[model samples]
Target: MAPRFTVRYFVRAADAAEAKARALDIALEQTVEIPRDVVPKGYVEDEILGRLETLEQAPDGRPGFLATISYSEDDVGGDFLQFLNIVFGNSSIKPGLKVEDIGLSPGILSLCKGPRHGITGLRARAGIGDIPLLMSAIKPVGLSTAALARLAHDFALGGMHYVKDDHGLVDQRTAPFSERLKACVEAVGEANAKSGGRTSFVPNITGPADAILERAKEAEAAGAGAVMIAPALAGYDVARMLAADPDFSLPIVAHPAFSGANVVSPDCGFSHRAFYGVLHRLMGADAVVFPNFGGRFGFTREECRSIAEACAVEMGGPKAGVPAPGGGVNFARVPEMRAVYGKDVMYLVGGALLQEPNLIDGCRRLAEAVYA
Candidate 1:
């Protein structure tokens, strides 16, 4: 047997046959020297199979792993995040750890369904190949279905390719998710029919575990183009489950709602790229939405860029996802935003556009700034 390099994931993930098959078939054996103390006592075959191997130690005292895991081709059955969950979603949250060597298995690689609709596919779908896709959101959840749908109609008519419900828009008594979803879908469709444009309506479906999937299914059934969810709000596993569900095929847009606690601690939690980038992609999000630089939330320019890079970067299976740089991106920032995000990005400008003197004109200027 030949020695091979390995990498291990630490988070709680889906440990299914596909993951196991990927590990066995894809990874090659590799020799590594782990610290004497880290390996737990009574190691069994169960532990060795789909277990994290040890390698060198980190300066921070995190035990490194000599990983022997690889993605199976069959593993491409679900969302990218789920793929990662199965690999290392749990381990990332654990206390002691360091990624050791990386092992690639042919099985998982063969099955990996790289981005089904990556930046290129998204642009094609939006009918804007040479420029970034334009997106907006309807928010302040108290609004009725008609009110939100009217906004959706205007945005679609104004040349926005995607219009999603604010992650906050849940199934409130005032504006139930289903009714709002149906109304918005119809509104966008009506606008597209007149304009002959491909406007996609993405409704927020963030809810409890029991209701989340039902909401997603309903949104899809209502002719919605995509469904949005705050994975952290519902459960990190929720996105993966929806992605894997055969009938729930609409692209999932992952939002970082309620996940602020994890990244606030620099030393304890995962790096921003690891969470917003790697983990979100693995969860099966075709497009991962995050707060952009110069936004109210205070994400730095570099951080925003990293998030964008993560969405486009090459992964084990498909091309990376669309980096939806949202949160206070405005018409004025279009030139600067375009310079950073490039044409293969999704420009999400919301509240600012709504506050503008003319919502339609503001959108046009924003689009021009990006396309120009």
Candidate 2:
């Protein structure tokens, strides 16, 4: 009798009968993980067990069936990880199964509450009204704190809305996190004084589990515009927990590092949209960064669009998140990207801008192109 959320999985099978059996197996496997013959009776069989709501052939011409299995909220117990276990759990280890989409129930939303500063909030933070946002990263991990901070300053002066630390930049000795953060904050503060622009300096907070939340708090205290984290690398729940924490209030920029294996397979792991879009939103990422189409990562235009749409789709109460596509984004592709994502996206470009002799001028021109 409890409320239930649905998970749509693409199951490979030769016939409808086999597909139905596989879906039943998932219902049992994801929930009880026991023999069907002895799955207990009464409450376990009724309320706790997952219900197979629908099963049909994949309309996309794929050789599989889309099976929707709904599970009771009682199975989740208001715990996020438990909820995820019910969503994927042991099911992920088995081949021939792919998580295509997950329905967000009231239980899930009540548990997570999604992003604190979603699309509109990020746009407001950038001091822009109805325009696409610009973001870039300070890269080459071994740079000194002063050098990295200088890149932060120049990026701000060039009209970037948010300048972030490269995901690979960690608490290395050359540019200690504390030292780099302080330098970037100060540098951007100096840039704001001259440019009269509200460019925010974002720092990467991805690190060991015990330290990331501490780093996020430090960044917030240090006047960082936002904090970036590779949720897949730092642990997905880490990002969600920070967003749920009342004491930590900085907007989260999610990076899709080390996530290819979960998505590259044709019939396993997850779809590009499900992994990069829905997962990030659930983890409360204001901006979900991913490998863009026409980029070196080999994501197709359709896959990129699916992610963009998922970021801003109407998902009950949670606010729409912004999709940030990077990985080889350049000036030449701006117009084409704009055509696909419209005015709500944040273009993450660095090498293309840094290649220009005048970093500020290059950024300005990119902004002009975005506006046009």
Candidate 3:
């Protein structure tokens, strides 16, 4: 038998028998996608069909049962998307099923390069030890390249360890990607020269598939310290390609722009940790951004903490990633964030800083609060 990977899921049902039935149904629906009896007798049944390993009551006692299913690595065909498809592809559309955890085989790990910079490398790049790294986005779009560059400069000058383009800022006439990339990189460079800080400018590179690699290369040549991409929009494999490429050495920050639907439900799709933490880390995200608790996005405190834990938790060989909790984060929440995430996190503050009368001063104060 070939080496296989395991996926644990919460299967909602009234009884153990029903849960077991549903688990078996998933093994069929996720794989061959046809009637089990009609499945071929040879390789299809022996190698392709998912094997149910266990079916028992859920640990949380949430009116569901825990089901562990194992799949042959051959079924994944050494492809990332196929691996994802095997994990939760067809079954995701059905209700009362949530992916709780994934156990990757060595073959799966070999298929991914994981995080290139990761947490330690990113910390080293920022020249900060164990303290929580500071990051903010330059935004509201519609800003000219020069205007955005000025914001990037101010952010770096004000001591933000990393400055990034807002996810919404793309190749618009107001600020073309190339022009914004060049100007912001230069602006941050100038600020670093004056402040003697190793602040990095991270530009969003999410765009047409053909344009992503070119933009990433351009961003590197333009002196960007890191690059950001919304994997949910650009494609998860694209992020994996950049992370795996030796030429693109800059850190890749994974933004959770269109991934909310994957984790919003209690009994469907993916768990917060699986979608935002483990999966992104596997795809080579140095830092994974998600909506914070108490933010407008409605993520629960437990859900947010679980994501942070997943990023830093031991997962065989993948480098630990930084969990960046943003989306409505503010200066006032620094103490609370510190208490929650400790020093290994990247505090992402955006619009809150823009609300201050002086953007530079607001960022400085924000930095002080974080490092203090």
Expressed as tens digits, the lDDT of each residue in 1-372 for candidate 2 is 888999999999888999999999999999999999998999999988889999999899888899999999999997888988898888888788998998988888888888898989898988999888899999889999999999999999988999999999989999999999999999999999998989898899877778889999999999999999987788878889888898998889999888887888977888888888888899899999998899888899999999999999988867788999998998999989999999889999988887889998999999989998
Pick by lDDT: 2 or 3, better one: 3
Q: Estimate, for each residue in 1-372, the C-alpha lDDT of model 1 and write its tens digit.
A: 112223553322233343343333223221111333443444312232233343222334332322235333243343444444445455444443223223444443333443446666667777876667888998777988898898899899889999999888888887788888888989999999999999999988866667778878988888988788887777766776676677877777788888776554533355567678766765667788888888788778877788788777767575678889888787777777777888668888889889988877887777777777
Cα TM-score per model = 0.76, 0.98, 0.98
Candidate achieving higher lDDT, 1 or 2: 2
Clashing residue pairs in candidate 3 are: none
Quick one: best lDDT, which candidate?
Answer: 3
Clash numbers, per candidate: 43, 0, 0
Per-residue C-alpha lDDT of model 3 across residues 74-133, encoded as one tens digit per residue: 998889999999999999999999999999898888887689889999999999898889
Candidate 2 positional error at 116, Å: 0.4
The 0-to-1 C-alpha lDDT of every candidate, in the order given, reads 0.67, 0.90, 0.91
Poorly placed runs, candidate 2 (over 4 Å)? none
Residue 224 error, candidate 1, Å: 0.2
